[model samples]
Target chain A: MSAALDAAPGRELPVLAVVGVGLIGGSFAAALRRAGKVGKVIGAGRSRDALVRAKGLGLIDEAVALEDAARQADIIVLATPVGAIPAILSRLLPFLKPDALLTDVGSTKADVVKAARSALGDRSECFVPGHPIAGAEKTGPEAASADLFVGRTVVLTPLEENTEQCRTLAIDLWKACGARVVLMEPDAHDAALASVSHVPHFLASVFMAQVSGADDADLRLSLAGSGFRDFTRISAGSAEMWQDIFMANRDAVLQELKAFRALLEQTESALAQGDARELHELLERAAVARRFWGSRSGHE
Target chain B: MSAALDAAPGRELPVLAVVGVGLIGGSFAAALRRAGKVGKVIGAGRSRDALVRAKGLGLIDEAVALEDAARQADIIVLATPVGAIPAILSRLLPFLKPDALLTDVGSTKADVVKAARSALGDRSECFVPGHPIAGAEKTGPEAASADLFVGRTVVLTPLEENTEQCRTLAIDLWKACGARVVLMEPDAHDAALASVSHVPHFLASVFMAQVSGADDADLRLSLAGSGFRDFTRISAGSAEMWQDIFMANRDAVLQELKAFRALLEQTESALAQGDARELHELLERAAVARRFWGSRSGHE
Candidate 1:
């Protein structure tokens, strides 16, 4: 309902189990704890060492097995790679508490939505497919921060079978963690994210590949300034993580990439034709749009 | 010559006239004045109000007519747009004193070299073409910083006819302003710059165009974060300036753009085919290259 209507105000809140206690999951645990919105946080992952580290860092109150945590957790937060989400959801389903509120922080929504539909079945109303549009190049539990999602957007893709109370509980939890929550259809979430996130990452990688593919790449890099640094910065992110994202959001990403390629071809044609006015007009439109967007996003 | 081979030291240096006192030109005047390497710095531009403002900010010791300043200046720095450089050279040729050394701050090299060859003729020995790989989204005299080129690379493309003394003078001046000068052939400079700088600008603009082309662009932009901010930052730069750069280095930029397009196609196909391994490998190569380049360039 409202921000004043806390997820569980004036009561000992539910235990929130964060599976795959890395950046996203760890940050969720830390932020919830920092906000005094949870009674306990459990870390579940394949790596015992990482889970122990997360516990030591107070990102989680304790490290536990996923099945054990799923049986006891009042809420289950699946924060893993997109490709890994479906498998993890299947595993958690058998042990999950009937009243548990399940949510995931994945870049792609469609695949996760499908996973919830297949795995949760009659209990799908408790599962919410979500994506928090916030992260840094560096990852892991050690890199997690309580304010990672503050002032950031978190999109929730609720299924038609989801109960209104389940949806409101998810939103209130995210709000308590200091994020601005927005609702969208699964396909809509994927498309919007493809434009703003997935496609941009691919473009950065493509541009980086072009420069490195050159014979004198080192020489070209030597002359690179802030422009090159900022432009290709995202290309240095984890390749494995991005590969999964590309595959999970394939159709939307492909469509946006096609649009991007078309614009690039048009720009290249203008340059080849020595059409200064045409090139200027194209750049001018992009510049104006970017400026307007940046101003709205407090980037200006 | 070493940086110790000062352009002017211990004695009051000759009058330095900065034609087209905008960002590049204005910064030159400011850095030289800060180093106390000149007796007086004169501002020359078509905009008298800007010239007066430059003088008021002490970016120039005085504001003067271009022809009048050219007649008396010992060193003339052309800081105009690339498209305007040739015409400016033509105008300066008749009024240029034999001993006056001429240099320009243009982004592209080949066109400026051709202009110098055609306009200077036998006097080409006194001209040097340079490109300082330093700038910001902001422009004009007000945005000029004395340390703009400090620790930055400034490539000098001296004509074959350039005298040793003339070349040394240009290097000395740039060195005195704290720029690390690198020698390059005009064509080589353009090609290298296209890979590192020019193509990246176009790519940013193209990506921006793609995002904004969507009907729900505002919603998409609301989800845009730091990665988008950094990736498309260059797209916010002055359109008129970039248009000139794209046109001046048309052939080289087109070549780089083609390479970039091919890479994008490869990446797109990998995603379309759900070839995770191929996508991962491509991204891995790009990530490795970007990390290596970033480390060398202090971007890491």
Candidate 2:
């Protein structure tokens, strides 16, 4: 570790390394830079051109190899796809400084935790799994913003081996990015997100595919209004990212999907039987709950 | 009909009546008034207090009984729930002038067409079945706007018995409100709407119900980001309105639901089997189509 970085310990600004410098990593770097909480940002990703662009856009102070970044960074953020977590963690473990804190911005928690445990072994104490519940359909560094995490939630799934210092620093990092940090068990986080995030994105994609594959797709698209537009908005997200999420969070997502399908079947039965009272009750329950959430969230 | 309305025939501004002065009806009245396309707007609904409020808000010049409005109005708009179409049509026909024109802003056209044919009989020619594909989750006259239909599509399912003049006038009325009017078969409109609008709303409502019904609903809702907010926005719409729509367009909605469920099963199977390629392909198809639509709609 650098003498300057160790001079004041936790009080000093972080020398951050962001692997996979895409939307999530780039935005984190930008947000911390804007808040004056990051002394320097080192970016590492598969694409050299993207890293150069990120540096040109001032999202990073330097573009370096993953091993070099891990060796020097005070804090390392693995912001790659969930499927890449294990491999990347394995690569960085050999060069990671003993005092350095490690965190990630993958969507699913349990899988990432497992991957970290398998890859880092005893060094897993330095890693805190996280997910920032904020994104746009747009991708890459050019779409990154300094305020992307402002007023958003960042979930941290701290491991049993994680020291208090590691957990506290992880929380502070996200908080400095203008996000509210919450602690959760990795499994619980996965299940809850599967219900709220994963399943919704999956359903939207399935619906979009269904509509677009129809014989009269052009006609249907032409007639679609704002309802369809908003309902399917998340389906425009990166396919590889969603694929990793669905695969990584398979069990929880499947459980939620099963529950959702059961509810849908009930609704279909009500409509098929022309049971107006039952249908109205079902819709009313949903409408009431949605309005309550919208009001509380200030999204109405 | 008034002598002033009859004096100039098609050239004179018509005395308009909105059967249910809620968002759709009130907005139509407000938009027409803003465009100076109507001589006066009469409001009629079950809620006298609401009608009075509409009058106070200047959404209508008068509040009267349905039959009274039917007798005086040169053009009448039935904006009541889909289930009310037949009963309202029956009550209005006794007092409706032979030269007067009638239309409706129901979400489903097939059922409305059937109701109009049964209730209006030969006079169905004067009643053009229309569905303006625009709305907000809010209801009542207070939520109405003078430009709600601007740049929106209004589908007119013209009856076989309707005169060319009736169709033209219906088209002109929507055009004056700054909406683009398109002609469609009643059945075709219902099928297309079920695919794009009705099923999406139903699914959103169903998903909302699922999330709220979960044991950890509060946690899930708290963690939900912009995607969940937008995905469930339409679920907050009026329950009674959607109930009426589902019942009225039961067949088409059920068919679309069946198709959607099938696609969802395919996704589930892929996820269960860990078939990454299949899942990626499905997500990519949806992503491409949704991106194209979003770009075209200027929502991205």
Candidate 3:
């Protein structure tokens, strides 16, 4: 029945195969199944334990080995770490069919796009690189849920070599998952995300490190509340993942760091003068700017 | 009626005069009134309009001029900007009765303590400086609600010279308002909050400035979601208030900013080298530390 249907249509919901069934991958499986967009969803990973659990939990329809899963599937979703993307693509490249749509959900895009293009032979054009700008520090398959993408932005960084069908299919899949999709070239996307995403992680970490080094660290911790907790929350996420993001987008991150340093100097000078009004004015600008922006965003 | 009952010893609930009928001040008044702890809640502020409205909304039993309110009330709460504390206290000093409990809901305790010492004639010992870590970005009397302090912390900074009754009475008032009272010294509270609260605002503002400066600021604003918005939420607070906070705790703010810069450099170098293990290891520490500290403070 499926074979005849596939032969008849323009795009019969492709057999969606997911590799690395962690948070992003598991979420992808759940979203696909819940939306009823894909014909069938398959899970592939090195962990047989995870695969059995994934199938049992109905996170995917069937569990298959990685290489076999890639060869048989019509669309491949790689939701592994940025560092792991190259190796995962390399392993699956020799087996991928021509029409298969290959994509990823890594935070950064340029490096992943390069790796996918090089590893997938002519199927590079079939590759659609993506980043779901949605997360929590909490990870693993147990944390996966179907409605995670609601009201989140899923950014797609399609390369020069990416085919029109690749971009369209990826957009349709994310839209079905209840995400707002935005497109950019891989390099531009990587640059913007480094400033918006990766830099924030490092800044929060440094703030934590300062407090940890304090003589009254224990006291401050007890006194810390929602504002401080929210500010430092992401500092608790995967260090390795953060490191990859920082390294991947070093130039942009450094540029942002410099800007923060200058602001600090100006604030320090203001304090030294005991010029309360002048200091207040500077902080007022920052405060007003943030408040105004939040108002404009409709969330305040 | 209130004075006649108050003169009869423990028969009358002490009156609390909140000096500003904005969100925090109004909420504090409402909470005290709701709990039935105070015999009378009077408001004293420059905004006759807000005071009249606060009375209409039943936030206060009376809206009197600052001096008139100070002459009658047993407690005076300076619930305004840190910069205005000195001037506000100077005006209220002549009207305050002998042994009246003077306190504030200022964010910075050190500055307030200094201002109180300089402003009050003899009963500086009656002054108990405090910060109730309960408020919303929403301001004015209209946004005031009684439940704003239900589960938040109220940190009191009692100087060594401050009387025990002053401390006890302050804590009692906060407890009546349903706040968890945390006691600390003025300098320590200022320094500690500088690390936890003031520094986070600077980090967010500096980071946001770059993004807001971008040619596509509007586009970025639209694409941002709950997490990004949540993380940067406090940046939208009153600039005048934040300016005072940052300026008052300038040294601590600068030190924290420097530490962040160094940490970013380290993270940048690590990312440039693609050191996923080292990066992840650091981030893992930050996540665990933040969770442990943040959760304890009721921030998570």
Candidate 4:
């Protein structure tokens, strides 16, 4: 830490350029500020209104041009959806300083890493891919909070040739936001997230839609309490954002979805046969497993 | 409403007998008293400790023997788990006045109604099988709040033989708790609930368990966030309770589960084939449907 500080002749507060000031970027800025860790936070996004909102909310100290942010800041956070990362990286790569750090908050990373390796060539060493396991169904700067990442896990998938400076700084940024950082391979991160996150997103949306489909819609919505609300919350997420994740984590998302289908078939067969005993047992097992899951996830 | 009130002479303030005193029972008792809709709340449970706790929490005005409650109360609530309804009705049947109102807060009905009808014989006409579509992932008296049913749906499955007295009382009880009451056939109610409630519970449990079976348990849990938690919240529901619901709503639960399975398979095949366009279209539809659900559900 002392060596890092001493490396510069004139000590200036570290600057992190946050691109696409939506839920991830805005919250990243707030979390960094709340911890009193990073020095200067610059907000950048295609949406001038969102950047303004991010700045006014004190999520960032200043609004900086995306290109300038890439060149001047010591760290750059591309907080856009996964599909947007490749194009954004292509545009920002040339503008980035030789030693500047690049990272992303995309949910799916295998595609991001591949895109980065291809687009940035040798400079891929400066890019680190990380995802903070923190979000809500709601979006935009307003939904972002300083405590969003508190006690949440953040996974970083650095390429084999990636520099320690890039990886360590990336880890430190997440840690400063109160996240417990873990390192994993890009494919592993993508696959695990598909099972835990993206697949659930699709499942939730489909189930909610199906329930609302069968006549008496208003009555059904009225019947829906917290259980239905919670079960289907993710279905309301940014459509395009989920599309990006699905495209990126395609293989893994489908794999988990397939497994879920098999389980559903067994449940369906029991129900179709009016085999109350079998249905009861399966539901019981599911309930027990889910109880364990609820307990485990509730505390976190 | 006015006729029933004037007809029943006011002596000793008619007690509202609550048979379970778990989250649902305690919440109902609190809502009834706090809303000034009931004269007294009588709590009953097999466990003396649970009954004592419910009474101590001001969830009930008194904790008494089930027979005593059945004897003293003008309104009786079988708020216990569905499976317990049969035994409870059998034990309390001989003590219930034919004119005294009886209902329930079970999640699933038809079977509970059928079973209780057998127990009470001809007097079962007074026992209305009701299920308030309200609850939290949390359970027990400690988890109870008077506002649990506020602005939520309460489905009352009335039988063809249900007297006007029974239906009116059932609606009034739920309305007192700020619920929007709906009257449906017991079978239809069971079918609709299995699709909207029970199916979601099993899907959630299966999704979580599939990942739990993976080599990395800790990693899986760490990656799960609000989306995963919300989707699987019902998985934490009582094992025995869900078991009973599955048996009761077997036909509908199976049908919904099958539909969910077919969709899940389609999703998987799309991914396996790298058909991003197909996946995108499916997810986008869910996302749109979910947006309406979110506004209705008041989700963030």
Candidate 5:
């Protein structure tokens, strides 16, 4: 499937501009380069040092200003945090090529779509909001890999204003990175992510913070095993990025958190009442579901 | 350190019996055999098929009844689910050798210690309540590995009635399996484990149950990425074992759950109120603590 995408006959390899060349952007550039699916790659970010490092690593052909990138590149990917999306979109709108396809690697899609609509107006037709569901806790160009998106999923919430050409291009780009692309409505994407990604990240951070705040935290951490290690792995993600995500997708995340809290309360009540049957059934349902998911997803 | 323990001079290799013959028991017997630290291994469990498999795997020299194992072995390790510990202890008490050392690999220490005291009376001194801080979601003898305890922590809660010789022998047994052994009070061990392990498992199960029970569960599961995979990995654990753990360490797990709920509420309030500063600080604190722990534990 990826081979067909990578070997697109008669399709021109477009010049790619990756704004905010951190793990996500750097990895996208690296993946496309490995697949021989792009022309020159231009890196742009607030961090000059990161762009330089990305160029040195050959993930990008050159480091350029965001405006220069928007003016020259045939495709531009905004890979910055959700909070920075609006300002960056506004900055690029003036220099953006009329035919250039624009997309984002933001975690929250609805907010990014809304920001693009506000910033680009009618030009929003060129934009496709995307989220590649793959990452490590590690960040930055140094941690980026060409295989980061292999066998991962990428969700694209194409705006009604988006041109069919632009949507196709965005899907092809991720497919070339060895990712399975799924399309959903912007709100649907937000709600699904809130349940699967956003709320899980928030809960991990909350759990980690609670444990760390305890007086006997050092002891607790020492006794922590592989289970704790895996459970709180996402808590090590960048604070700024997560804060933006929670704020950007506020309603969906809040709803999911409420649902989670209700389940937690039910569990607590079961334990308090010494309801072994209830507790076991709850755990059995979860275990069966988790094992089934793991089997289907090949994650176990 | 492990080499020192593995090469204990002039110490006679004990005839070992592993009760339950599952992941924990099978692995213990396998590790001791690999280190040449055992004379023989007798496996005892409720499942005759599991015992047969364990014996075929060479994890045990023979399969025996609990009474036969207790009478024959120099060291008996109760590596069953916490809920089964009391019943197993009662059955083994009649035939337990006077000079034999006893230990357990139950997740919760205090309850196991309590059960031992009730079942064995003065003989409880020979039972060192231990928890190996290592596991995978997969259970049974087939999942057991000789290296399962390597570089892991084995926490021992030695009773005040425990003989010095019995305690040392228990510590050495774990050390021979390439584990780092630490002594902790049973209550302290329970509390720390609740914070780091038990509560995290419960939360994962609760979250999984909530998501699985959702109307759009298939969509949510499709979008679930590596973060969700790792966060819910422990939820795939045996339901019966976890139910036993939650019930056995009820107070500590409940206390930890209350603390987690409080922090979760604070986070929800911050998000609801759009208190970005508060939310950012909480996330940052967690990120810092998680990264520090990851670095120290070499888990990242």
Candidate 6:
């Protein structure tokens, strides 16, 4: 933290550059800007149109090349899709300032941790793996909001190689964005996320597939109401983004899916056998459990 | 429609009786009362406390014994748990008036249809089986709303024994409550609802079971957000009610569950094999299909 402060000299605001200025990245920049903690935000992306749009929306102070942003950044935040993080890190490595720190807001952490090890080599100590568990059905800079991360959980899986100062600085940055930061091992983060996020996305998508594949799909869809709407909301997310998350966290997601399948099979067998008592117990248990969790999470 | 009109005799409001005036039944009574289509609403339930509460809340005009309510009724609406419908219908048979029409708001149609056939015998011609596709997280008479069925689908699966007059009366009743009436065979209603509602309920329950069964459930749940909240909302439904629904619609629910499991297996295999394009295509298909359906359903 002191080293970062030393590099910034007399400036009160830190120089921040956000790579892949989409929803997450743009929101982070906007939040930091609103907090008056960022000196200048340079947006980096493959699309000139998006970068231009982001700047036009005041989500970024300037739009520049990825390497150029990296060279001048005091803190670099990668907000690209999970699959694009590795290559972007590789590209930013050469131009990365000596005192600059790197963090990401990707959905998965273990993959990012591995990518950092391979791409940063000796500079791996400057990188912190993080994921802000916040998103909407829509994406892109236009959908970004300064308050998106407020009251949300941001999990950080810092590498053992990362310096104490680097980790502290990354945590401080997420805090400044109005997020609650929690620390966990990369594997633990992946497993937990597999249960909470990845599996739900896949389940919703599968349910959608089942309904749409039906012979009277249009008729069935016509009868679907609020319950179906909420249940399938996340399935409407971008395929490119979700596919990357699915591919990156394959092992953890597979384990969760297997567990879910076992539960579903149990329910199926109970229903098939006309075991009303057993079915009742299973549903009661789940309903009670969900209510408890919802109350604890303030959702109920 | 003529028979019902003939029975009414004059310009008098119809004498209505509501059996098991919980959420659905109570809502129907309230809506009809609001529309001035109903005269005296006699509430009947096993729970005396519930009946008293319904009367107090104006969900019913008075509380009475089931037999008494059935004797004086011009129309009867059974709004009980699916498992309880059969016995309730049996109990109402001896006390039923010759011109009294019968309807129900059970979640499963086939089971109720079978129950009506067995219970009413020759008088099954006057019994109509219907389901209002509306609900809330809460239950009981206190949760009843006059507009609960407004703009919602009320599916009627009339038995072959049902006279045209009986069917018309039930349709008119639902329409008076602001519901859009759709006629289908009992089996079709069960199958369609199994696809759109029952399976989603169980899937959400099973998903909740999987997550809550984890060793670090508290941690995982804390990390869950709006997506998980919406996906699992149906899982928080009343256990007694859903269990009965699952049991009553067992065959149809099982078929939908099997279909869902097959779709899930496809997604799992794609994820396991690291087939990014396959996963993307699957997700893309689900996304596009959901969007199309959502647009048509006016939910987007």
Minimum summed lDDT over a 10-residue window in model 2 chain A is located at A1-10
Q: Can you write out model 4's per-residue Cα lDDT over A1-300, one digit (the tens) per residue?
A: 422222344576567789988888888888876765567888887899998988888888889777888877777889887787778888888788777878898888889999999889999998889988887566899889888888888899988988887777778878989988999998888878888898788888667656666676665565666677778778877777887788778778877777766766676666677676776666566666666766766641
Q: Output the TM-score of candidate 4.
A: 0.91
For model 4, the stretches where C-alpha displacement exceeds 4 angstroms are A1-10, A33-38, A61-65, A270-300, B1-10, B35-37, B297-300
Please give me the DockQ of candidate 2 compared with the native complex: 0.80
Candidate 3 lDDT score relative to the true structure:
0.76
DockQ of 3: 0.50
* The candidate that achieves the highest lDDT relative to the unseen native structure: 5
lDDT of 5 at B9: 67
Question: Could you tell me the lDDT of residue A54 within candidate 5?
Answer: 89
Off by more than 4 A, model 2? A1-12, B1-12
TM-score of chain A, every prediction, order shown: 0.94, 0.95, 0.89, 0.92, 0.95, 0.95
Q: What's the C-alpha lDDT at position B165 in model 6?
A: 83
- Give a tens-digit lDDT track for model 5, residues B1-300: 212123356765678999988899999988988878787789998999999999888889899999999888888898888899899999999998877788999899888888999999999888888999988566899999999999999999999999887888889889989999999999999999999999999999999999999999999999999999999999999999999999999999999999999999988999999999999999999999999999999788
Pairs with backbone N, CA or C atoms under 3 Å apart (clashes), candidate 6: none
lDDT of 1: 0.85
lDDT per residue for candidate 3 within B224-247, as digits (tens), equals 654566667777677677877877
Error of 3 at B247 (Å): 2.3
Clash total of candidate 2: 0
How many clashing pairs per prediction, in order?
0, 0, 5, 0, 0, 0
Q: Give the better candidate number (4 or 6) by lDDT.
A: 6
Q: Summing lDDT over every window of 10 consecutive residues in candidate 2 chain B, give the lowest-scoring window.
A: B1-10
User: Regarding DockQ, does 2 or 6 come out ahead?
Assistant: 2
Question: Against the true structure, what is each candidate's TM-score?
Answer: 0.94, 0.95, 0.90, 0.91, 0.95, 0.95
> What value does the lDDT take at residue B54 in candidate 1?
88
Descending-DockQ candidate ranking: 5, 2, 1, 6, 4, 3
Scored against the true structure, residue B96 in model 2 reaches a CA lDDT of: 91
- Chain B vs. true chain B: TM-score per candidate: 0.94, 0.95, 0.91, 0.93, 0.95, 0.95
